[model samples]
Target: MSAEKIDLLNFLQAHPPFDQLPQQALEQAASNMDVAYYKAGSQIVELGQLLDTWHVIRSGSVEVYRRSGELYNRLSEGGYFGEVSLLQNRPSRFPVIALEDCLIYLLPKAVFSELFDSYEYFSDVVEVEDRSRLRHSVSQREDANQLMTASVKVLLTPNVLSITETATAHQAAIKMSENGISCLLITDLQSQICGIVTNTDLRDRLLTPGLALDTPVNQIMSPRVFSVEHNQQVFEAMLLMLRHNVHHLPVLKQGSAIGIITLPDIIRYETQNSLFVVSSIFKAQTLDELVSLKADVRACFVRMVREDANSRMIGGAMAVIGRSFKQRLLELGEAQLGPAPVEYCFVAMGSMAREEQLIVTDQDNAFIFDDNYQPSLHGEYFAQLGKFVCDGLAACGYSYCTGEIMASNPKWRQPLKVWQQYFSQWIDQPTPEFLLNAAIFFDLQPVYGKSGLVKQLNQLIRYKAKANSRFLACMARNAILRTPPLGFFREFVMEKDGKQSNSINIKRRGTAPLVDMIRVHALAIGSKAHNSFERLDDIIESKLLPNGRAEDLRDALELISIVRIKYQAQDLELENEPDNNIEPEALSAFERKNLKDAFQIVSDAQKFLRFKYQPGRAS
Candidate 1:
C-alpha cells in the first residue's frame, strides 16, 4: 500500500463504524479513498447537493446545518458525515460546512454499502434513522427481563389502605394489623399521600423509642414517601424501592394516590435481584453481621452491571445500600452506647447524600446537634456516638474520608446554630479552601436522628444561596476550576503528574465538573433538588440553559457515569479495588467516541458557566 493509503487506513481504524469493519475491507476502502480539502467557512456539501460518497473528518472541524439554518451538530476529527445522504442515495438534506481548514476522506457509495451490509457493528452505528447513536449506546445492553418491560400498574392492586395524618400511632398500627398490611399511606385532610408508616418505622420510631401510643402517626411516618406514576415501568418502581430502600410505593394515577406496590411483588416477578440485600441489612443484629454483608453489597453492584442497569439506577441502589449501612450502624451505636443524651441528626453528605454514590466511595458525613445542645454536659455522649457509627462504617467498606469530613471529625460535629453559621460564612465570605469543604455540605441529607434539623439546614441554604449573587459567583468560579478532560485537539487530556499518568480520573474530569456546574445552575434557580439528575430537571424547567444544553448535560452525565460504573463493576469482578481513573486505551472504539462526546459536553458547560457568571468580567 502507498504511504497515503496506509495513513488513511490508520485513521479509519481509529474511528467508529469504520473501526468495526473487517481489516481486509477496511484496507480495500482506504486504498480506494479519495481525499478532499476545504477552507474555513467553505461549504463542503450544500443543501440538496448530490452526495454519492461518505465523508470522514480527518482533521479540523465541520458543522452540519439543518435546512432551517440552525446549527445541528459540530464535528471534529474522527467525526463522520454524508452517511445519511449516501445510505438513502439522495441529495444532502443537511448541508455541511468546514468550521476550519479541513482534510477529509471520501469513500465511494458502493464500498460503504458493502461494509454496511457485511458488518453488524458497522450497521449498528450507521443506522441512525431507526435509533440515535446515544440510544444505541444504552440499548446495546440486555433488557430481556419481563419486569424491565412491564408497567408498575400491572402489579397494582385496588386494595389500597391509608390513614388520616391526624391518626394516632396506635390507631395506625391497629389499622395495619386489621387490614393485614405492612404499611399504611398517611394522607391529609385533602386526601393526599403525605407520608407512610411501615412496620419497620413503627419498630424503630415507636416501639424502640417508647413513644406514646396516642402520638400522631405523622410524628413517626416518613414524610418523603417516594411514589411512582401508575404508568411507569415495573423496573422503575423497583429502582425507586431500591434507591430509597422503601418497601411500599404508593402508585398514583393523574396525581391521585390509587394503589401501592411492594418489594415482594417485584421479587416474585423477578427473584434474581439485589434489593434483598437491603432487607437483610436491616435484619442484621450485630456489627460483624453488618460488616459481613459487604460481600453481598459487592455482589449486588456486580449484578446490577451485568443486568444492564443504567448509571442512575445503579447509583441510586448503591446509595441506598450505603445509607442502610449508616442507618443500621447508627441503630447499633444507640444499642451499645445507649440512647443519645440529646436529639441530633446524622447527615450523609457528598455522593451518598446526592444519591449518586458508587461502590468505591468513602464516608462523607456530619452531625447536626440540636440548638439546645450543651457541649460540657452532652458532648461526650454525642462524641462516642459519632465514633461508633463512623468506625462501624469503615468496617463495612465505606472507608473514612481522607479529609476528615466524617461525622467523627470535631470540626463538622456542631449544633444547628453552628451549622447555620457555617453555611453563612461559607457563602457570605467564600474562599477557595472554604469552597472545597463546602461542596459536600451543600448536598446534605439526614439519614438518622432528628431529620427536621437537616430540613432546617436545607431551607437555610436555599434561601441564603439564591439571594447571594457574589457567593454564587464565587461558587461558579470555583466550579470552573475543575475543567473537563478534553484537549484543544478534542483528545482526552490526562493526568500529567501521577502514577496513573496519561489516564483520566473519570470522577474528577467527568462527573465532578458536571455536578459542580449543575449545582451553580440549581442554586441560581433556587432548586431544592440535590441529586445531579433531579437538579438538571429543575434547571431545564427553569429555562436557565441555552436550547438543548440541559439534555446535553444529562446525556453527558449518564454516559460518563455509566462508564465509571461499568469500570468499577469490572474491578469488583477482578477482585481488585474499584477506582475512578480510566485509561483511554482500555475503552472500546464505541465507548471512546461516546466518552469524548460526553467530555466535550462538559467542556461546553464549563464555558457557559464562565460566560454566565463572568463575575470579574461581568459589568
Candidate 2:
C-alpha cells in the first residue's frame, strides 16, 4: 500500500470496527472504504439509493431530511447518518445532504457484508444502532401512551400538551383546533382526575343552547368517565380508553391522581430498561438480595443521568431504595436478633435514616430500647443482639457504621430513659458535638420495632426545640457551617489534598448540611415528616420559610442529591468504589450555579433561624 493508504488505514483501524476486528481483516476492510469529499449543499445519502454506502461523518455537517416541505436542521460532526440501512435492512429514512464542505468515510454495504463475515465487532456495531432505534421508537410510543395517564405529581405527563376538565368549552375547541386533542381530563383539589371534556362537549353544551364558551365544565363534562389505573399497561389503558370511545382516560393509584399518563411514560421506561430496575427492587426479598440488586440500581443511576430521568422520579426512587435497605435490614435484624423484651425501635440516623440518602451510602443505625423495668440483665442480651445484627449487616456491604452509631455501640443503643435524658440535655444546652449528634439522631426514621419510641422522642425534641428556640438556632448555625461546597461565584468547593483531592464532599459539605438544616426546621415545627424533602415541604406549607422559599431550598438540595447519585455512578464504574466526593469541575454551568443557589439558601435559612432564636434574643 502507498504511504497515504498506510496513514488512512492506521486511522480507520484505530477507530471502531477496525479496532475490534483482527488486524489483517481490518487492514483488508480499510482498503475498500472510499475516501469521498463533497461541497456544501451536496446530497450524500440520496433519498432512495440502493443503500450501497454506509457513511460515517469524518468532517463538516450532514443534514438528514424527510420531505417536510423544506430543509431540516443539519447534524454536526460525530453525528452518523445511514444507520437505518444497517439496522432496519432498508433504505435511509431520510435524504442526507452536506451543509458544509465534508469528508466522509464510506463503508459500502457489500464491503460491510464481506467485513461482517470476518468481523464480529462490525456486526456488534450494527446491532447497537438497530437496538437503539428500536429503543427510541419504543420510547416515543411509551411517551405518547403515558400522556393520557393521570397523576397528582403533574396534572399531565412530562409532555406539555394536555387539556384540563375545567378548561372552557370554547377553550377546548380552540385547543383542539391548535393541538388536535379530542379531550382533556378535569382535575379536582384532591387531584382525582376524571371526566373528559371533548370537542363534542363543546358542541353539545356550548353550541347547542347558544350557551357561552365560558360555561363551567361541571355542567356538561362527562360524568361517566372511563379510567385506568396508573399501574396498568399503556396498551391496556389505550384499549380501555378506545373501547369507551373516550380519547382521555384519567389514571389513578389509591384514588389520588399522580399524573395523566397518556401512553408515554410506560412505553419510555419499558423501552429504556433503566428505570425498569427500580420497579424490580420493589419485589426484592432480603437484605442480601437488596445488596445484590446494587448493580441494577447503579445501572439505573447511570441510565437516569444519561436519559435525564426527571428530578422527582430520580430522587423519589433513591429515597425508596434507601428506605428499602433500611426496612430490609431491620427485618433481617429482627429475624436474627429476635424481638426485644422492651419496646424498642431501630432508627436510621444519617442519610439512610433521613430517607434522603442518594444511591448506595453506608448505613447509619441505632436503637432506642424501652426501659420500663430496670431489667437487671438487660445490658448483656441487648448489646449482644446489636452486635450480632449489625455484623450480619456489615457482611451484606452496608459497611460498619463508620461512626459506630449502630445499636452495637452502647452509647447509641440506649434505653428510652437515657435517650430522652440525652435529648433533654442536648436540646436544653447545645454544644458542637451535641449539635452534630442531634443533627444525626434528629433525622432518624424508625424502620422497625416500636416506631412509637421514635415518635415520642421526636415529639419531645420538637416541643423542647420550640420552648428553647435559642438551642435550635445554635444548631441551625452549626448546620450552616458545612455550607454547600460552592466558592465565591458558584464554583465547586474542592478538597486541597488526599485521595479525594479536587473532589466535592457531597455527603458532608453538599447534601448533609441541607439534611441537618431540614432536620432542625422539622424539629422546630414538630413536623411528622422524617425525610428531608417532606420536611422541607411541611416547612413550606406552614409558611415557616417565608413565602415558599423552602421550595427553592428543596430544589437546590435535590440538585445536590442528583449530583451525588451521578458521582456515585461514576465511582462505581471506576472499580465499584463508593462515590461520595463529587468533582465540581465535572458539573455543568447550570448545575454549578444551582449548587451555589442551594448553599446560599442553606446559609440564608440558617441565618434566619439563628436570627429568630439566637442566644441573646431567645432570653
Candidate 3:
C-alpha cells in the first residue's frame, strides 16, 4: 500500500463502523475511498440531489439540514453523513453544508453497500437517524445509571395500606401491625390520601412522647406527603426523598395511589455518595458537625462527575445536599432558640429552588410567616432563627447571597399574606426593580417548615402572571439583558477586565441567560416547573416554540451546564476554589467548537424572545 492509502486505513481504524469492520474489509474500504474538500459555507449535498458516495469528516465540521431548512445535526471530525441517501437509492432528502473548511473521505457507493450488507453491527449503528442519535447521546450521557433508566414501579410494594385521618393512633398501629407493615397512609373523610404514619413517627411522636394511644393519628402523622408518579424513574424518587429527607414515597397512578416505595428500594440502585452526604447532613446535631461534612459534599460532586453522571443529576444531588443542610440547621436553630414563635416556611430561591445548584453557589432564601404574626412578639425569634440558619449555611460553603436575598434579610422575611401581596404587585404592576426581584424570587421552593406557605404563593404567581402580558414582556426584556458570550463573528466574547480577563463567566453569560429565557416562557405558559429542563418540557408540550426549537434549547442548556460542571469538578480536584469563569484556551478542540455552537443557540433563542414578547412594549 502507498503511504497515502496507509494513512486512510489508519484513519478508518480510529472511527466507528469502519473500526468495527474486519481487516480485509477495512483494506477494501481504504483502497476504494476518494478524498474531497470544501470551504466553509460550501454545500456538500443539496436537497433532491442524486448521491452515490458516502461522506465522512476527516476534519472540520458540517451542518445537516432537513427538507424545510431546519438544522438537523452538526457533524465534526469522524462524523459520517450521506448514508441515508445512498441506502434508499433515492435523491438526497437532507441537505448538507460545510460549517468550516473540511477534508472529506468519500467511499464508493458499491463499497458502502457491501459493508452495510455484510456487517450487521455496522448496518444497525449506521441506520439510526442523526436527530434520534443526537437525542440518544444527550439522554444517555445524563442518565447512564440503572437508577435513571428503571421506573419507580419496579420497586413499589403493591396495595399500600391506609387508614382514615380521623383514625386513632391505636387503630393505625393495629392496622400496620396486622398487615405486617412499617408504615400506613392516612386518608381524609373522602378517602383521599392526607398524611402518613410510620414506625419512626409512632416511636417518636407517640410512644416515646407518652401520648395516649387514643390520640388521633392525624396529629402524629406527617401531613406533608412527598410522592412520585408510578412511571417516574427510580432516580427521581431518590431525588424527591433526598430533597425533602422523606423516607416513604407513595407511587400514584393517575392521581390515585397504587403502591409505596421506601428508602431501601432506592438504596439498592444508588451507587453514588450523594445519598451519604444527605444522610450525614440529617444526622449531624451541630453546626460544626455539618460544617465538617463540606469536604464530603465536594467529594460527592467530584465522584458523580467522574462516574459520568449528567448535569441534571449532579445539580439535583447538590441541591438536595444543600437543602439537607438547611433542614438540619433549622432543627438545630429550633433546639437552640426554642420553637419558632409562629408558623413559618424557609424558602430557597434561584438555583437551589430550581434544583440546579452546584458546588459554587450563594444562599438565596426567605421566610414566609403566618398572617397572625405579631412583629413585637415574633420578630425577634425569626430574626435570630434566620441569622442562625444563614450563618450555618455559609459555614457549610454556600456563601451568603451578596444581594442579601437570604432569609436573614428583613425585607425578604415576611408574613404569608405579605408574600402573596408582593407577588401580586410584581405581576400586576412590574417595575424595573420588581423585575429584578422576579428573576430571582420566581423560582421559589420550600426548604423547611410550612411548605404550603410557598405553595400558596406559587399558586398566586401562576394565576396572575400568565394573564399579565405586561409583566411577561418586562421579564422577556430582562431575560435578554445578559446575552450569551458570543462576538459578531460567533467567537467567544470573553470578559475584558480583572484576573478573569479573556475568560467567560459561564453562569453569567451561558446558563443563567438560558435559565432566564426559560423562566420567561414558563411564566407566560403558567408552568409550575421549577427546573429549567422541566420548564422546557412544559414549553414543548404547549407548542410555544417553533418546530425543533425547544429541543435545541434543551441540548444547548445541557452542553453548557456539563461543561461548567466539569470545570468546577476539576477545580475541586486541584484543591482550588471552584468558579464559573472558563478560559477558552483550556478547553479541547471539541469543547471549544461545540460551546460556540451552544452559544449561538442561546443567541437565537434570545432573538425569538425579543420578537415574541415585544419587550419594547413593556412600558
Worst 10 residues of 1 by lDDT: 128-137
lDDT of each: 0.84, 0.65, 0.88
Better of 2 and 3 by TM-score: 3
- Best candidate per TM-score, number? 3
**lDDT (Cα, 0-100) at 113 in candidate 1:** 89
Tell me the spans in candidate 1 whose CA falls farther than 4 Å from its real position. Answer: 1-272, 617-619
Question: What CA root-mean-square deviation does each model show from the true structure?
Answer: 18.6, 21.9, 17.4
The clash numbers for all candidates, in the given order, read 0, 32, 0
Q: lDDT, candidate 3, residue 573?
A: 82
Candidates 1 and 2 compared: the better one by lDDT is 1
lDDT of 3 by residue, 1-619 (tens): 6899888989999987787688999999998889999999999999999998999899998988889886767788899998878988999988999988999999999999999999865775586334334443454343344455556766778968999988899999999999988899999988899999999999999999899999999999999898987657787888889899889999986578999999976774353477767888889988899999988888778867765567888889899889999999999999999988889999999998999999999999999999988888899899999999999999999999898998888898899888888888888878988898888999999999989999999999888989988999999999999989988888889999999999999999999999999999999999999999999999999999998899999989989999999999999989999999989999988789889989999999999999999999997
Question: Which parts of model 3 have CA positions greater than 4 angstroms off?
Answer: 5-57, 61-272
TM-score for all predictions? 0.61, 0.53, 0.65
For 1-619, candidate 2 gives per-residue lDDT tens digits of 7996787667766665455566677666667778789998788877666577778666677666665523333455444567566646776667888767888888777777677666555665565444433433334232222323322233245332344656666676776678656666666655555566766777777788898878776667787876665445455665675687665556654465444554444444343343455445445566556567666666555555554444445555555555555556555555666765667777776666554555565667887887762447577667776776576556545678677777788888787888999999888878777876787777666767788888888888778877776787777677667766657865566888888898878777867777777777787788877767788878887787777578767766776777777767677667677667777678764456556766777667667766655634423
Question: Sort by lDDT, best first: what order?
Answer: 3, 1, 2
**What's model 1's TM-score?**
0.61
